[model samples]
Target: MARNNWIAVASAQHARRGCAIPERGYMQVCHGKRAPLQRVAPGDRVAYYAPTVTMGGKDTLQKFVSIGLVKEGSPYPFDMGGGFVPFRRDVAYVPAQETPIAPLLDMFDFVEDRSRWGYKFRLGLFKVSDADMRRIAQAMQVDLALLQFESLLF
Candidate 1:
C-alpha cells in the first residue's frame, strides 16, 4: 500500500493537535526534528501512538490516536512563536477511533519482548512492516479500502 508504514509516538494532546489542523493534518516527531521526517516519503502511512494524555505526564493513554497518509511534500518548518520552529509534514488524516495498544502487542513484529512493548516506541518514529500497519488499521477500525483509495496498494 504505502511506500512505508510508520509508528510515531506523541502525547494524545499533541497528537490530537496535529490531526486537528484545518484542511490537512500534520505530524512532527522527535520534538520537530527534520532528520527523522526526511526518511518518510509522500504516500507513506503513519499512526500516532500516545502513551499519555499530556506530555511528560503520568496519565497513561496508550492509544493509537491518529492515522493518515503523508501528503506530497517534504518536511517544512513552522513557527509556533517564541522562536519555536518545528519541521512537519502534511498528512491526510482519516476518520478513526483512538485505539489502545494492549490488544495488538502480541501481533507486533517489531516488538520482540512482550514485557517491553513500550521500548520500541522510545524511538519516537520508526518504520513498520505492512503486516504491522494492517494490524494497526484493524485495531483503529480504519478501513484499508479507504486507505487504498488514496493510491495505496493492499
Candidate 2:
C-alpha cells in the first residue's frame, strides 16, 4: 500500500488516554463525523497533536505527542456500551514523546502565518504532506528508518 500521512488533534486528556489503550490502539477523531475517519488507511503514518501543556499529569510543552503507523483496517466504531460509540482505526505507535510546535511552525504549509499556528489544527483530523510528515517525525525523534519500513507494508 502506498503510505499516506495524517494528523490527528486531540485534547491532552483524550490523547493520553487513547495512547495508553492497547486494544484501542488508534486515535479517534471527529466524534460526530465519519468523513475524516474514512480518509485514513492502513500503512499511513499518523501524528497525534495535543494542544495542552500538560498531559497525563506531565508537562509536554504543548506539542505533537505521538507517532504511529495505522494498522490494516477501515474505520470501526467501538461501542463503549453507554451510547458512547467512537470510530477508530488500529495504530501501532512508537514510544511516546513530545516536540513543541513552535519551532516547526515555519516548516508547515498549513501554518501560513507563524503567529496563527493553532488554526491549522482545528479540524481534528486531516491529511498532511509526506514532507511535513517526515519533518514532524524527525522533530518527534522517531526513527526514520523504522518509519519508512512501516510505510512500505500492505
Model 2 CA RMSD to the hidden true structure, in angstroms: 4.3
Cα displacement (angstroms), candidate 2, residue 106, comes to 1.4
What C-alpha lDDT do the candidate models reach, one value each? Answer: 0.90, 0.77
lDDT per residue as tens, model 1, 27-130: 99999999999999998999999999999999999999999988999999999999999999999998898989998898889989999889889999998988
Give the best candidate by lDDT. Answer: 1
Per-candidate TM-scores read 0.93, 0.83
Model 1's alpha-carbon lDDT is 0.90
Model 2 per-residue lDDT tens digits across residues 36-77 = 878888888888888764434455456887888888888888
> Which candidate leads the pack in TM-score?
1
TM-score of 2: 0.83
Name the regions of candidate 2 deviating beyond 4 angstroms.
21-24, 53-61, 149-154
